[model samples]
Target: MKADSEFKKVLTLFPVVLFGLAYMVPLTVFSTYGIVAQITKGLLPAAYVVTLLAMLFTAFSYGRMVRAFPYAGSAYTYTQKSLGSYAGFFAGWVLLLDYLFLPMINYLLIGIYLNAEFSAVPVWVWILLAVTLVTFINIRGIKLVANVNFLLILFQVLFVVMFIILSIKALVSDGSVQSLFSITPFFSEDSSLSLVFSGAAILCLSFLGFDAVTTVSEETIDAKKTIPRAIFLVTMIGGGLFILVAYLGQLIYPDYNAFIDPDSAGLEIAAFLGGNVFKSLFLAAYIIGCIASATSSHASVSRLLFAMGRDSVLPKKVFGYISLKYHTPVLSTLIVGIAALAALIFDLETVSSFISFGALSAFSLVHLSVIAHFYIRGRKRSLSETIVYLITPLIGLTLCVWLWTSLSSSSFILGISWIVIGTLYLAYLTKMFKDKPPELTFDADEDIKVSS
Candidate 1:
């Protein structure tokens, strides 16, 4: 491994989008369908639409920031450069909660699913097996990860398509074509705008992958253009899949109260749509989806660690070192793999609480960064620039705050504790504010061409 080695620029827009969608795990809409359906009073599609519009505002901010700093580290890099080193450090630190634990959630999902299917095999074995496989693919390189994710995501999409077709068939068999065209999924006498917003807050987590694409900017060609385009495409495509699936699911099973269990409602719907065999296939697709999500998130966190390490924010020797032969961050990937083993001890609910906190925190900072870099600092205050840089991000920040208020008390406790620890570390690293924290170096000749 060479400390100075750069990542190979092998990714393009298509694979990058694949990585984002894989990280999102489009089939996730099925897993949470019942709970969201209940929350929205059967208006899942309306909730998804609200969530998508909110995410796009933040996605637009990400696009703006990536053009100015087309590097790895995502929000960490953007906030550090635009907002001051301290704010940037906290942004990266809090984001670590989201990036670091997401793979653990996937690993836990694999263990739980596999253990249920094959009771003879221990859950830890499945967790370890998944962690090993994902870690190995990530260590080999991003291209292989992208290729594997493409196949996994392809399976997920095929399953979603099958699910949609079956839902439509079931609906038509029971009713008429008019049954498929009802606005009840988007709005009904029982649902209200407040309930839709509540559901939107919950569904916001489904759009996590769009920002994860920014982590691979260093390994992407013409990253300034490609990364931003991939962000919007991923957000729109992922949101589209979620909204469509929710709409169809609501149509097929309009009576949300009929579910036996809200948490396992997807399984119930699967059983109804395709019977035992299709239900088994659905389980298999879900396991594959978990693997795909774990791999992408594993790769993402490793790159984020590498970025922080390269700037001497973390240990330069351990976290900063990239494999010369593989062009991947070997140590950082291994560290994430090891961290994922905690899945053996932690449950999904506990791990999930930390994710929304970190994601919302990073999103809020990115919006602020856009205003700091483009509006206040650059003095681009023309009417168009004001709308783009100020008003847009202001709306984004407000939505993030709204979502933040919806987070659980556990999320606040865990997130605040993580931030406190990070603050102490930053103090020591910067010698009690007597010194400025380390900064990422961007070379002038590095072809970081910004587009409007």
Candidate 2:
């Protein structure tokens, strides 16, 4: 396929709309607890501040790379160019572990929500049904997916707005919360440093799905501009909403702690004002948002597979196949659906620590890719571009390493195990394809040698 033709497939209003909604939900609801916890513990708004600063560094690195390469391969292409093929493939490979789990998380959460009302239908049934239903829709073209996302996102956004409105009504009835900030200490009186860190780290999970936009860069028209802008725009929108909703909860729900427990944890805050009725509504919203999360994940993983196929890292036939009618990856989509469903049967809480492991690792690589590219190509190239690509990635690397250390031991161990598995798979594929007609474009860089 001509590059332009392939890229054009991703150009649509649907992605933009889905992204806008995803950004809002996580920030408004999820971040309320974590961000507030971080702020209270740090004696200020450290979580929100850290998030913006961290994203700025990472986003800039992404912008520079997308403009330079502007291909659908994203991390696969950039890492291949800077770190070499093995590094690129493994970087892309490990990410599969994290993204691969998204559908599981989504479907599982959706089932739990549906159980609130439909006591008759088991939550697992709802999960299976949701995955089965969405799988066929995704098999259609991205155009249809995007169209559906636009409506789904609209409802998601509406639910959040409604919650805020209802809570505001309660606040007005009780007079005002203008002096409420004075009541809570700037620094946490209860939480230890470790507890606050763990809490803040959770926000990264909510922050992640938007990066999937890059996986489709190969299909996006004007992606070099649209993708990056969409990211920053979404972040600001979500960030502002997070801050507002946290304050709203604090203001309206005086006894906020009652809502949170081991079962619901950070989310019980929604139950306070909503009561039984509002709880049901927000619960529905949460599940729907998770479905959106699964949809976003499905779209992303298939693109990753598509790119891997292009590099001949996977069975070129399956991963590389695009539906002529839909211009989407049919087989890869099916694979993602099946894999996600498989994860559902697992007791993932035992493995949930590893969930964000590969994603952070991939983000780390992306940052380093920019630095490495400039460290090599910069001296012979434009100085400003070099600084944009290299310096920003260096900052991103520092932030990522800091966040990496903050991960739990369980996560670190599971993450490491996944990498080892990826290495073995790469070697097996390499040997199997050794006699094949097409060969992978292995990097010439000596530094990128595969461990196998």
Q: Assess the local accuracy of residue 4 in candidate 1 as a C-alpha lDDT between 0 and 100.
A: 48
Candidate 2 residue pairs in backbone clash: 7-219, 10-219, 40-188, 72-218
Kindly list the per-residue Cα lDDT of model 2 for residues 1-452, writing each as its tens digit.
42211324456434763644452345234423634454345322335545556666776777667766666566767777778777888778767766777667677767765775688998778988888877887788666667776766777778768867877777677576654444352245664555544544545555564566677665666766877776666655665555566556655554434443434633565666767777667766677677666776777788788777765677766787777667777888899888877745765454356656776787788898877777666553467765676666788878767766777788888888888887778768667436322324533221111110
Off by over 4 Å in 2: 1-7, 10-14, 20-28, 31-46, 172-174, 180-186, 192-195, 253-257, 265-267, 348-351, 380-387, 431-452
Scored by TM-score, the top model is 1
After best superposition, candidate 2 residue 53: deviation in angstroms?
2.6
Error of 1 at 214 (Å): 0.6
lDDT of candidate model 1 versus the reference: 0.89
**Ten residues in sequence with the least summed lDDT for candidate 1:** 443-452
Candidate-wise lDDT, in order: 0.89, 0.64
TM-score of each: 0.96, 0.85
